[model samples]
Target chain A: MTSLAGLIDRLEDAVAHRTPLEKEHVQAVFFLFPLMFFIVGFILMPVLGTLYDAFMRDVIFLEKEFIFFTNFRYLFSDPGFWNAVRFTLLFVLISVPLELAIGLMIALVMNETIPMRGLLRACVLIPWAIPAAVSGRVFELIYNYSYGAANWLLRVLHITTEPVNWLGSEIGAFIAVVAADAWKTTPFAAIILLAGLSAISEDLYNQARIDRAGFMTRFFKITLPLLKPVLVVTLLFRTIQALRVFDVIYVLTGGGPGGATEAVSNFAYKYFTAGDFGYGSAASVLLFVIALLLSLFYVKASRFGEA
Target chain B: MRGPDLHTIRRRVSGRLLILLCLPMLFACGRGDAETDLVFAVGGAPSELAAWEKVVRKFEADSGISVRLLRQPANSQQQLQGLMVAMKSKQQNPDVFLMDVAWVGLFSAAGWLVPLDNLDRTPFFGELLNRTDVYDGRLMAAPVYLDGGILYYRTDLLEKAGMTRPPETWRELAESAKKVQEQMRPENPGFFGFVWQGAQYEGLVVNFLEFAGASGGIQLQDETGGVRVALKANLKALRFMRDLIWEYEISPPSTYTEMQEEEVRTFFQSGNAMYERNWPYAWTLHQSDGSPVKGKVGIAPLPAPEGEKGVSTLGGYHIGVSKYSDRKADAKKFAAYVTSKEAQRMVVLELGWNPGRGDLYEDEALLERYPHFGEFKDIFRKARPRPVIPYYIQVSNVLQTYISGALARNRSPESALEHAQIEIDSLEQRYGRNPEGGGGQLSESFPYPSFTHGEAVP
Candidate 1:
């Protein structure tokens, strides 16, 4: 009892003689409480709920029973899930490198001494500024088989005798969707690369020039090596985004032409919309794990942020 | 100025903090007004909503109840998803739901809709009211409008081709469409023979159902008292659909990518296709002054195979009071009002929606305005409902996928049907035979209660 009283006395003394740092900490906690509450309540809770739902049999009006790993077993055996994974990987493989190369070229051009460089940079970002859904609709129009600009251009150039059904076949739909996605997101990569380029010291380039290095040589050795961290970061973001590609594909083809363009996210969304929440949640959890592994691989492979 | 004491500062800060916390609560409490606001959730084109808004105003004035119209996603699948989410969460804001005909069984089976046993359904078409309105031995929804797949053709082109009547068989229609296309190709280079909703969506399922029904294709059969897929007729129908695109070249290759009703309507309205299979609403659009086919359009029942009668897939919207609604009485009142004969007449005349009431089809003014209400009534009477099972969404998903694959030439019709049958069987086993507890009766027979018709639209 005496020790308890002594502890209480110590606590009261500390409170009465609180330091400025302690007062500041209390104030910071008060300010951050709402934000912390929002993050935990909205984001964290839903994620945990999804994980919980993944291990249960959840259908509408049916009793939800805890059936551990059954949903995962169904997913593993489901051809649609595997098809979605294949297409998602194919999309990432095709779109990310094209985005990186085209983005790097644009960033290099924007970094050079040129007239109206700011305007040019702004114009390059127009595609990215447009919402993905709106851009998707625009691309849908552009790829229309009967009256699209693409076919008109092809006809005017005398390239083909007939208009191509850009979204009517599997490979055609896949290519068209990939092009649309790359068109909308390449500018984002370019902007990031441009930022990285700006951060590199101009003196380093001058020093390379003094060493009689050619443009190609300097590009390979200096720009790429120095831009590694930014490139890794940009690739990680784009890779994750590409794996879960949905909006453009949903609007453009709706994973049609025999589900040729369905991404993992689209597949999960289908199950979710169909009210098979358990299977959908399982697919989502698998997607989360894949994304985590991919991000880890990228970080490790690039030795990101290392000297 | 005198310096404030520490206690006073603490009290002031605490008071401000309390108000900040209570502000949201205060606003929430402020929403409790005397006037009851009933929310009706609906989906469709903005123009369709505009037509319904007039009806809503009349109802509001008569009942002295304010209504907030909540517009849902235009896509039917997305709309269904949104409603399912809201109902799953038991939201009470949407007192009334404007549901597609197919959703009546699913929603009612899930116990999301209130049973409107007292609503007088005698005025509605017997088939629609009996087949789609009832669920688990209860009248769950009231039909607001009736729709079915109809064939729209170019009258001028058919006349030019020396044909006075629309073709009645798929073979005949194909020949006529090809003749018209070849005849018109010299003048209109963009012309095609026929167009329909071939996209891999619900519309595709509706189109397939029409063809399948006409060809005597039963999706499910009672074989030895066990439900099984009847594959032969479905395979034949699928082959015929595929031939429309690849073999006959009647439909454009782009049909594989078209996803909505509007796409087919646009092709037909632009005078690019000789014939279009679509819902009844397309007739009004095609007859409007802005359409290229205005005054040149004709409506008829869809062509069937040789040994069968023409069949149209049943479709329309029904109004139901949400089980979660706080104002069920008001919601039921609104539902009853919108489906009343007077409102039905106005909607039918103005919006080109087929009235649910059988007697309205025979009204002199309505027949004068529409001119083809007789044929429409006949089609609705004989319209075949898509399988009325609670797991219909999943079943339709599987059907559309395989049917689309067959149409796209990604898989043979035989293989596609085989695959689809397997998937559908699994869906049945997983979800149970019938979620509606209807004893897995295949809906081949009219098992629900029937109403006496005032007058048949012969």
Candidate 2:
């Protein structure tokens, strides 16, 4: 205790002698050190390790041997890997725009000053709040060929004479996967866009009203231009998330129906579980590179910083 | 006035930061237990886990050794993954665990399983033990239970169709299925003639093996692990499976899309089908008190092509001790206890599981309760396992894609098999043992001490 008291006394003297700017600099570095340590330990190290593993033969029953680019060579020629890539890209192309459009309308409705508006916003998030795996199982039941809601409703509405095989056919499996994913993730897009919508000043709408502008005209001329930055951010975020889609497809289709709905993530995970780490790592590294390139393109195309 | 409060807040924040930095150190050094209890990992349905718990308790009481029962995920895939992670990192706790029949090849080759030569192997089936449990000419695992594909037919429906016995050939089975379907369609629009596992999974491969007749499919050419998959028999079987869905129209379209073991079982139990192919466990469920098919189901060997004996795919869990266990002696004792005839009988009586021991088939009480045991003995004896190779899962994945693709009519069976054969060849070259002895480091050496029979416990 005496030694601690003496050290505190010496620290007070040192603090008094040092410039406040230097002390502030020390505190700033002290605060940032932990964050930097975590970033390096958790994120950076594993990624680099995976990059290293991709170039080695790391199967569980095999000896580790450094073989540069061999795994990538095999992966590129693999029809199953290509099939997964095509499915993932096609999924993003369809689901992203579908989600954005649905989310925009939802954001528009939730932005209105209505009764129990807060409750409505929270309720809109319920599907998003549920874990993707849980929701995927629910959707699996919903698409059941024998007694699912989709077929039952179709029969009731007289839309078709027979029950459509929703998860067995390639096209059916693709559609089911997209619909399930959009249902789970659209609310995230909506919440982000809702914040952007709320940030738009009421005065802008008031000015448009005074100018005798219609609602559509005001939205097109003012709202969309101002919302461009947020839209770009949401697109980039959702695109990255969609590229790495795994849990929902895993639970629902299991990359089944002849591998029609296998995404790149699921493809990589299969190899990993099968104890072929080198092949799995190579597949994942390819996905990471694609995600990085796409994000860069989005940023460059949108001129996000200037916006 | 604000300077003193701000100073204290800064101090508090720095103190918290220090704690945060030390947090990882705590976790890094956290596992300090001088743990002596044997950790046994097992996974199954809730009822199966409860049965395992009872068996564990009995062993603990008899041996005077405490045992920890670790419950893993019910899904076999997840269970394999959990064991892989623990074994790869070489955690010693999961001293003993249950392994799916398919994983024995990988686990044994990876040197994760401890040798068990001391235990008496007299009771277990010699063929199953040699096929799955033996590696490097040494015993590495012991069978805990057994499973095989069986033909389930509705007795009343067969009798109504003026048939006294189940069909014995694929052609006959198809004809009978169509005959019964035509008569039953008017009463139940949802009725079909047959159902089996055709979804893209491990079960699909097993069904294909059975369909390929007694020799099964995919021959391992030699010790170097060369595989031949595009065989004439496999093509015939694939075409017949596709015809069952489209040509004969005896099975539902969903057979290729969704039918698994449980799905096929439920369909047959609901009286929607005349013939069903599934595991032996489904019999108990089909004959349950409230079931629609109670006392109306009959079991037989799956039908094969002409002039060939029917084959069932061998499947079940095996108990093995981890090589890295700190408590191998105790773990081995537990393994022996689990595989002992008494424990096996208890498991069979309580859970309705097929006993891993062959002698149990002759037990009067068991046979009295389940007369079907007499029929299963021959089937189990002849059940052909999927190739017991280290990279069987990868090979199975490739097979799953192309086989289901053929069933789905995406390609001709010949072309699908051709492409699948090419993919599997490359996989074998990559994962198989290399001539230089640099790849597929199968544990061939045993420097570790082997257990001695009738040894005193320390």
DockQ of each: 0.34, 0.39
What are the TM-scores, per candidate, against the unseen true structure?
Answer: 0.89, 0.90
lDDT of 1 by residue, B271-293 (tens): 89988999998887888887888
TM for candidate 2 is 0.90
lDDT of 2 by residue, A1-307 (tens): 5754665565455446545764674467566777977898899999999999999999999888998998897787788899999999999999999999999999999999999999999999999999999999999989988878988999899999667778877888889999999999999999999999999999999999999999999999888888889999999999999999999999898887878889999999999999999999999999999899999999998995565
Error of 1 at B435 (Å): 12
Q: Report the C-alpha lDDT of model 1 over A1-307, residue by residue, as the tens digit.
A: 5764664564445445546655554455547657766798799999999999999989775678997997887677566788889999999999999999999999999999999998999999999999889999999899888888898899899999667888888898899998999999999999999999999999988999999999999999899989989999999999999888899998999888877788889888887887889889999999999889999999888874473
How well docked is model 1, in DockQ terms?
0.34
True-vs-predicted CA distance for residue B96, candidate 2, Å? 0.9
Clashing pairs in 2: none
lDDT by residue (B105-209, candidate 2, tens digit) is 999888899999778989888998898889989999988889999999998889767788998888888988998899988878778999999988889988888
Deviation of model 1 at B64, angstroms: 4.5
Q: Give the proportion of true interface contacts each model preserves, from 0 to 1.
A: 0.44, 0.43
